[model samples]
Target: MIRLVAGYATAALTMLVLDGVWLTVATPRLYKPRIGELLADKPSLPPAVVFYFLYVAAIVVLAIQPALREGGWRRLLTHAVVFGLVAYATYDLTNQATLKTWSTTITLVDMAWGTLVTTAAASAGYAVMRWIGK
Candidate 1:
């Protein structure tokens, strides 16, 4: 129970930090020129809220916890990278296929960002759980 809670907390927090940096710092630099027009002029509150809540939970439960049980950081990171790739790929590919205005550049960049965020979060979660257990 402790491990589970710790892992979840760490993963969620790490994800939040990574996302905050990406959205606030990186977005203007990396994304604005590429997809500025597609972005909402004002932030959309509901979907952002929903996505973070669900995404962190899913990463903690599905990737971080499993990796903690099965092995060490390598396993956790592998799981995170694969999970991130698959999850983000689904979204990006779907958007590319259906959304007439979606940019391939954005899809590629987002996929990379998703992978990075999950990898960092999962690693942090696994490390935190190990430390707490010790």
Candidate 2:
């Protein structure tokens, strides 16, 4: 129980920090220039909060826990990357299909960001679990 809680916290924190930085840098340079009209002056907090909570939970459950049980870094990374790719692709491709303003550059960049961030968070979760000895 303790390990699970700790791992989740670590992963969530890692993700939040990484994503915060990415958004701060990318929003102006990438998203705003391309999709400024689509963006709100200020983001809606409720959806962002919910996304973070659910995303972190999924990473911990699907990637971190399995890798810990199987005792392999390779397993953890593979699961993390696959989860990231699939999850991001679902969102990006859907937007590209439905939204006229969506761009291929955004899809590619966001997907890569998602995969990298997910793997980093999952790795952090795995490290915390191992450090605590479980």
Candidate 3:
């Protein structure tokens, strides 16, 4: 149970740091001009907070914990990537399908970024659990 909690913490922190950086730097650069003034300089805190909590929980529950239980780097990495792709694709593809202003470029980029970051976060969590167990 402690190991599971630690894994969750590790995944949450990893996602927060990496996703925060991407949103701060890459998102603005890639999206601002296309999105124009619609992109707020500061995101609203309530939704952001909710999203972070749910997102991290999903990662831990669906990917990190499962990978750890499966007990292999291959399983860890594969599940993380698949989870990321599915989650991001749901968001990006839905936006592309529904939003008038959404761009395919942004959709593709975000999906790729999601896969990369989630895998990294999950892998980091797995590593942390291993270290802790040792």
Candidate 4:
């Protein structure tokens, strides 16, 4: 139980730190230049918080725990990448399909970012859980 909590916390923290940097640096350079009109003046905090919570939970459950049980780095990374790609693809493709403002470049870039970040976060979570269990 404690390990579960620790895994979630570690993954969430890792994700927050990584995504903070990306958003700070990339938003102005990548997103703003391409989709400035679509962005809000400031993000809506409530939904952002909810998204982090849910995403971290999914990572812990779907990637971290299974890898820990199976005892293989391959399993962990594969799961994390797959989950990230699928989740991000759903959002990116949906926007691309429906929104006139959405672009293929943004969709591809965001999906790549999501995959990298999710794998990093899941790896952090898996490491922390192993340490705690020992």
- TM per model? 0.87, 0.97, 0.91, 0.96
Model 3, span 55-93: residue lDDT tens? 877878887667667767888888889989999999989
Model 3, runs deviating above 4 Å? none
Stretch of 10 with least lDDT, candidate 1? 30-39
lDDT of 4 by residue, 1-134 (tens): 88899989999999999999999999999889888999999999999999999999999989998898886689999999999999999999999999888879989999999999999999999998989884
Return the lDDT, model 2, position 71. 62
lDDT of 1 by residue, 71-105 (tens): 77777888889989889999999988997677788
Whole-model lDDT, model 3: 0.84
Residue pairs clashing in model 2 are none
Per-model lDDT: 0.83, 0.94, 0.84, 0.94
Best by TM-score: 2
**What is the Å distance of residue 116 in model 4 from its true position?**
0.4
| Comparing 1 and 2 on lDDT, the stronger one | 2
Clashing pairs in 4: none
User: How well does candidate 4 score on lDDT at residue 78?
Assistant: 98
